[model samples]
Target: MLRLLINIFFLSLVQGSVAGSEPYFSLADYDAASDREYIGAVGILSRPDLGLVITITVQSGGALLLGDPPVDKIPSTAVKRAVCGQVISFPNLPERNLVCR
Candidate 1:
C-alpha cells in the first residue's frame, strides 16, 4: 500500500509539471495583434520584509511592468510599487475576469 501511494504521488507530480510547462500564450493571436495594448500583467511589490503581487493594467500609463525584474536596487525610472503589506494604501487593482483595456 505504501509503495502504491508513493507511485501515485510521483505520477501526479509529473502530470502537473507537464501541464505547467505547456505554452499558455497563443502565438498566432499574439503575432496578429497590432499592439500589446496593456492587456494586463502581474507584478510584485516589495517592502522591508514582504512582497505583494497584483494583476493590473489600468494605470496612467498603459504598459505595466511586473516586479522590477528583481533588481539589487530600485531603479530611478522604475514605476511606483503597488504595495506589499496587510494594509495597502494604493488604488484598487482590478480583479480577474475584468479587462484592463
Candidate 2:
C-alpha cells in the first residue's frame, strides 16, 4: 500500500506539471443580442501570443421565426478573424470591434 501511494503521488505531480506548462486560451467575453425579430452573438478570443479577436455572427429565424434565441455563443465559435493590429466594429451589430493588443 505504501509503494502504491508513493507511485500515485509522483504520477499526480508529473501530470500537474505537464498541465501547467501549456498555455491556455479562453473566451474573455460572450454576448447575444436580439430585438425579438433578429438575433446575433459576439465573442472575444484571448491567448498569450495571439491578440484579441472579436467575432460576430447572426442567424435569421427564416420566415417562421421559430425556436428560442441562442444564448451560449462563444468566441471559439467564430470562424473568421478580424484584421491584425486593428479594431473593427459594425455599425449595425451590437458587438464592439475586436482590438488586438
Q: How well does each candidate superpose onto the true structure, as a TM-score? A: 0.17, 0.19
Give the least accurate 10-residue stretch of model 1, judged by summed lDDT: 70-79
Highest-scoring model, lDDT: 2
Q: Cα deviation in Å at residue 1, candidate 1? A: 37
Q: Positional deviation of 10 in candidate 1, in angstroms? A: 39
* lDDT, candidate 2, 53-76, per-residue tens: 223333332111101221221212
- How well does candidate 2 match the true structure in TM-score terms? 0.19
What's the CA error at residue 57 for candidate 2, in Å? Answer: 0.5
Cα error, candidate 1, residue 66 (Å): 10
RMSD to truth, every model:
16.4, 17.0
